[model samples]
Target: MTMILGFPLAPIRGVIKLGELLQEQVERELRDPAAVRRRLEEIEQARAAGRISAEEEAEAVNRVLRGMQT
Candidate 1:
């Protein structure tokens, strides 16, 4: 079971559950300008430091994102 859209509860998993939570978190984080700014800065810093290339950065972001997916 999962609590979705901040709703009481629902028995769901995988894409639906993940998508809802991601969207919710994204919206909430979007409201926090500083946090979003910091995240972008961190990503840019990583790119500059050669931790990730543009392509790798995209993949790495999604990989970290996918960790939260399920």
Candidate 2:
């Protein structure tokens, strides 16, 4: 059995692999302009619906827009 520091390594490796895959998918979605726009809209809708505070909405908007720039 694979081991690392006396702990099984297989489960650890699987967790790491899953994290990497999740990061890749998130990055891919963030790179898309439409995804950014959709997020912005969602943020605004949340604000309008009183689900999010103005500051929260602004921060989310800024983050989404910033991601689009990169």
Candidate 3:
């Protein structure tokens, strides 16, 4: 006999699995060295273009460099 009680939970389980996969992908990118360097370059360009203040650039550079260290 098939149980109907478990059917409703199937979509919930699939959503949870999808969320886990997304988290794993995000973590992998965060640890990538090239990704960190690219972010630093972007910050520099923004600063040069006056899109960000000098203080914001310094803060962003520090955050990106720290991410590289870890």
Candidate 4:
């Protein structure tokens, strides 16, 4: 019966749905201006603290800006 076949796939379906939800949340946050600003600030702080190099900071900032565009 279909139930027998579907039972094994139920967990897979749930995992897929969870992944979709997480993706949606990430996209929503990326579109948030404040969230983007905070990320940029974090990158700057890291650079100032020497936790990241200037090149790394630039790359991180570019990535955050690109995420905003998307």
Candidate 5:
């Protein structure tokens, strides 16, 4: 029966649904102005601390900016 076949797939379905929810949350955060500003600030702090090179800082900044566009 359909129910019998679906029973075995319930866990897989649940996992997929969870993944989708997580992805949505991440995308929502990426588009948030406050979240983007915080991320940029973190990158700047890392650069100031010499934890990342200038090029690396530029790349990280670009990546964060690009994420906001999407």
Candidate 6:
């Protein structure tokens, strides 16, 4: 399985289904300015704390943004 920041890209049907559901949930629930801001803040903190590399943080932030698109 390929992992996109712990998000697994898998051949399993269940995983794919769950991914779809998660995407929908995020779109409906977390697709807002406040949600985006919080995600950004968390990413920045992780980067400053040396928990995740700059590149990893960028990828994660990009993914969250792309997911928010309608």
Instruction: List, in order, the clash count of every candidate structure.
Output: 0, 0, 0, 0, 0, 0
Model 1 alpha-carbon miss at residue 15, Å? 23
Judge candidate 3 against the unseen true structure and give its global Cα lDDT, from 0 to 1.
Answer: 0.87
lDDT of the candidates, in the order given: 0.68, 0.85, 0.87, 0.95, 0.97, 0.83
**RMSD values, in order shown:** 10.0, 4.3, 2.5, 2.0, 1.4, 12.6
| Candidate 3, 1-70: lDDT as tens digits | 2458888888999999999999888878887978987898999999999999999999999987776566
- How much does candidate 6 score in TM-score? 0.59
Off by over 4 Å in 5: none
Candidate closest to the true structure, highest TM-score = 5
- lDDT of candidate 4 over 1-70, digit per residue (tens): 9999899999999999999999999999998999998999999999999999989999999999999888
Candidate closer to the true structure by lDDT (higher is better), 3 or 6: 3
Q: Using lDDT, rank the candidates from best to worst.
A: 5, 4, 3, 2, 6, 1
Could you give me the TM-score of model 3 versus the true structure? 0.76
- TM-score of every candidate relative to the true structure: 0.40, 0.59, 0.76, 0.74, 0.84, 0.59
User: Which lDDT tens digits does candidate 1 get at residues 1-70?
Assistant: 2445645434454668899999988767655657655766787789999987999778765644554444
**Between 1 and 5, whose lDDT is larger?**
5
Worst ten in a row by lDDT for model 3: 1-10
Those runs of model 6 whose alpha carbons end farther than 4 Å from true positions after fitting are 1-25
Error of 1 at 51 (Å): 0.4
- Which candidate, 1 or 6, has the higher lDDT? 6
* TM-score of candidate 5 versus the correct structure, residues matched by position: 0.84
Best by lDDT: 5
Residue pairs clashing, model 5: none
* Error of model 6, residue 9, in angstroms: 33
| Residue 19, candidate 1: C-alpha displacement in angstroms | 17
